[model samples]
Target: MIIKTPRLKKGGAKNVYLENVSHAVTRPAMESRRVQMYLLMLLADTAVLLGSFVLAGGVYRDQWPNEFAMAMGWAFLPIFLVIAVYQRCYSIRALDEVRYAIGQAGIALVLSAMLCTVMIFYAKAATEFSRVMLSLALVAAFAGMALVRVVMHLVLRRIYGPSVSSVLVVMDGGPKVDIRGAQIVHAEDFDISGVQSSPNSLDRIGRLMRGMDRVVVSCAVDQRTKWANVMRGAGVRGEVVSTALQELGAIALEREGGQSFLVVSTGPLALHARIFKRGMDLAITVPAVLVLSPLLLLVALLIKLEDGGPVFFVQQRMGANNCLFDMLKFRSMRVEKLDSKGARSTSRDDDRITRIGRFIRKTSIDELPQLLNVLRSEMSIVGPRPHALGSLAGEKLFWEVDADYWQRHALKPGLTGLAQVRGYRGATETENHLKDRLEADLEYIRNWSILRDIKIIFATARVLVHPNAY
Candidate 1:
């Protein structure tokens, strides 16, 4: 009876197993680092707030927000930044990866931008402050905060192990069940993750499992033999119970130390293709937004003045995994209509188009507002087109001949892609054309790259020039 004692509690962050979170429960080993990470982010956010204050000349001038109010404004910047980080964290942490911490740095910047926007709205700071300087500072804070977290990751990795956590157990049933159990036990902590195992030698395995705070065994392991059952009975009194197979995929591992055993598994979002797609999206879209801002605004105003209506139009669109976002586009339709409910595709002689609206839509100027969508992260520079999941096209939109359908939306929906550059635009009236566009979309997703996007944009430039008069 080498009673094992497990350390980790259930509901850990690494595993996305269950979802009743007052926030993901921290495992024992991470308790300290988790606290440290929060504190560090708080301090870093405070620093950024102070920097914003300094940039605003220490306070807003007369008729503007004053010193104390400005200080409070600085304070809210962090409050909002932290909240934004938290909202992004739910999915971001579940999909834990090396790149996530880096990507989150940008998320932090976007939060900061929103906070700044609020500040500008309230006139809490200098009206003439340069957007360039603010952007630079936000970028700096993102880089600095992320660099710190990476250092923390490295330190924790070295201190703990190059791995996450592991669990091992040694069960003795009969000679029949003994060999299989022993082989599994022998694999030991080699997996070096939260749920690693080595069940080869019974004594060795028992020793290893007992070394942790808690250990679990499958119901099957109990039926090995009478003596094994007796041993398992004693083990059960002290340890937890779970299938041996379940141990193979533990995302979060609890640590109770050399004389203890505790096990837990939960969030596990970051995976192969998902990670790659996210990396590429971040690498390209962030810089593109900075470069394309002027173009986006120019087109926006042209739409507004031409149609005498709102510059941007937002419509519900299905996002990744059936999530929803208000997809943005420059309003390219007429504002004089009595009803706004039934607007659809503009055609060759559509009544909605103003002289300017027609030109912009023909040249795809209406799509430029989405560059801001890219900045806000609702869309991408190049990927599959997004469809409203409850689309008007009916179930056929998904089931109808687009073989690689789901894979196309695997990446962020883009403003332009290979399909569009290949001339798959306008009314998706026929099933064949939709199928062709879907095929092109899937091809782009399957083989995606910055160079490919550049190629698509280049081809689109050619298409825009001719305008087909439609």
Candidate 2:
């Protein structure tokens, strides 16, 4: 089963499906195990929190917990859960490593307690509750949660044995990888060629990968890109065994035993970072939309009244992961001369732009409709700007001018970005113009923070009426 070759017919390769090789491996689903563990920890922590508060009430007031203590318990429990989830306190790693579990639990508990205390103080309810009793309950809750994690870790280790995850190694005529406890199948046996693009090909690969936490494909150099694309589109951690790190644009290099593999597609942001970015986007975009709705309405009405054309100028642009999406903007071009493909950059006093268009373009009001894109999660308030498909830098397409241009799509396209704020707005008339913006975009991706995003959003306000705007 490790090195079985597919039997070729006269004209084509045989299609070997996943079911043909199903008997080779049988293992418990790692995802289900993690879910059960998460549920158990949630239940355990809730009990510990409430019980701690009740016991503290008995010690302090010499009675069962009254409404205040129980209320405090309920409040602290939700806060702790939110912080704990963000801190990955109930993650698979926490289950595996006792120290990490205890540390994250402690940090989450302390942060949640501090936040709860601040809320109480602001609500003027601090005087109504006993501080000593609250402090005592928090201390007891932390101790109990820590003890629970340690016990649960020991029990889970005994239950699941040594393997923390299920890994699938698909040997596709490359180097043979020996991963302990991993189910190894010859790619030919499963008809899993990296070049196979048929729906059934993906279905077969997915079925074989169903319960696996990670899929490692050891394939020929030429097939690496296809396999990487397949894995990127699939819902699992995928790695390809390759020494061509430079060609693959490998984010990180991994070495296990004597084998070196290139990790092509881990997501750009972590879970907590995604949550933070999305929260910030909503925080700003929702209020901005509400405050600017009347202005948006006015702009739409004017555009419609000027030329009786469509309100929006929707065009396909490259978005995150090089996918195309319809980006919206207020129509600023004459109906007949509208450049849907964006073949040419808008020059100063261009006839294609309507009289109303010129004013909105000058004031940057034409871009206001993209606020909806931000709300839709199709765009961000701060990111690399999405470009029209036919956008050119000098005589070449943007990608042809610089290979790294596509790397900017790793993050969501923004309504405004570091490049725009730095006066890289308007046309990319030459390769250097594109290069400068690309450099800023890549820099933003590399050093992203909520503070930086806020700063970019603020900076964008200054350049709303730049001279380069048509």
Candidate 3:
């Protein structure tokens, strides 16, 4: 018998969804120059600082900067650059707006001051340097650096209104925009990038731009997770590609240079960095379980009394290395279903949730049992939320998904994070909503810190008390 394999199209079903897609709004043309500006600012600021010291010495007749000062000068710029990268002070997205520029510059300056102050004190160079000169150099460095952002905003506004649009391509949608800021405002204001939906609009706009500017997908109306990914991926070869919201927020646009696309996905967390995280889990779990045992027992009793069922609910959870682990939680549901792959988000009045379960979930007392997993090295205190792998129905259901959605999980899952505290906690978030949450989580992980974890823990507590927790 001859068996024939059925023919499959090269594009696959997914291609049909993408091929018809087009880019409408243009991305900011300022990326190249802006990068140069950042480098120049950092370097120039250091040069000015050293120069100011030499000038101060000349003016005060102390003989041009000593050998010790010269050595410090050599160390200063590189050290500041490291600090800037760590703080993401060089990131264009970090400079979201004029206000954000000031804020970031303030942070960078403070960091510089700390380093400089420490160096001066240690090197016994504090008395030798002019305080006012150092301060002036810092002020000049901050202002000069901030000027790049200011110019970028102004040039971009002149080009496309606000944010960093050097060109605009509006799609056809309900109520065509008649006036920029009036009844029918331009779609760019909302950070919506693509043509409102007008076919050939992008082509016409592309001709206008000569491919000089960035290409953005400005979703005029709400964008489904699928479309947002398509449009964001459609940026011109060299131009920036981002969502309207990102363009509007104008603070941390995703990076792509050579082989490096800065945004990370969640899948690799289970694969690449398992050992490093397992060590952290051992450290945290050992101490946490030791400290919170009494609270855990009390919570278990409360759960048992509130609902006449087993105190602990063991469900198969997607754990580190993508292995199946019987994740334990104080049973909050009256009756648990084995195939709850799809059941997520304990609602305000989920019938299955017992009265005490409601309180426990709101207060996050139910998650106390996960400390056992932490002790066992199954989870971390601050990472992405562990979702049932099969049940999640793709990230769109639980995250504000985009083309690079999976990149959010490069690290192990966390019990609480940047998402949970920023008013994104609780449930019923659509695809975009979850993606938004994941975005925050991604931001947290990419810029992880001990301080940030502390902040998240504090915010989680505050969210528990707020009336909106339900």
Highest lDDT against the true fold, candidate: 2
Give the 10-residue window scoring lowest on summed lDDT in candidate 3. 176-185
Q: Per-residue lDDT tens digits of candidate 1, residues 1-470? A: 12132332544441222121101222234435555655665566567555554544323333242454345446546555566557453232412344566565556567667766776678866564445545545555566656655775676566644323322343332122221112123122222222223233343323333323233333334433432343453352233233453445333445565553334322222475446545666777677667877877777767666646788767787665546788776676666652233324445788867777677777777676676677677777677777654432323555454545665656678877787788777665566767878889867765565446767767776676444434
Per TM-score, what order, best first?
2, 3, 1
Q: List the candidates ranked by lDDT, beginning with the highest.
A: 2, 3, 1
Q: Write the per-residue lDDT of candidate 2 for residues 1-470, one digit (tens) a residue.
A: 13232334445534533455553353556887788889999899999999999888888878886666787788788898999999899887888789778878887888898898898889998678688988889899989999998899788768765456777787787887877547777665655554365787786666666777888999999878877887777777998887566478677878999999868766679888889999999998999999999999998999899979999999999998888888999999999998989989999968899988999999999998898998989999889999988888999999999878888999999988999999997888999999999999999998787668988988888998998888
Per-residue lDDT of model 3, residues 1-470, tens digit only: 11111233455552232222222222335677667756765665566556644554444445576554455445556666677777676666543466565556656766877888887789897777656655655665566666655765566456534443143333323232222211111222222244556445444433433433432232335544433443444454322224553435344336556453333232343433455556655776788778988988888788777755788877776554545677777777776542356466555766877778778776777878888777766667777677654433234443334555555555656777788778776554566566667678668766765546656766777775544454
Q: Best candidate, TM-score-wise?
A: 2
Q: What is the lDDT of residue 2 in candidate 3?
A: 16
C-alpha TM-score for every candidate: 0.38, 0.52, 0.46
Clash pairs detected, candidate 2: none
lDDT against the true structure, per candidate, is 0.53, 0.83, 0.56
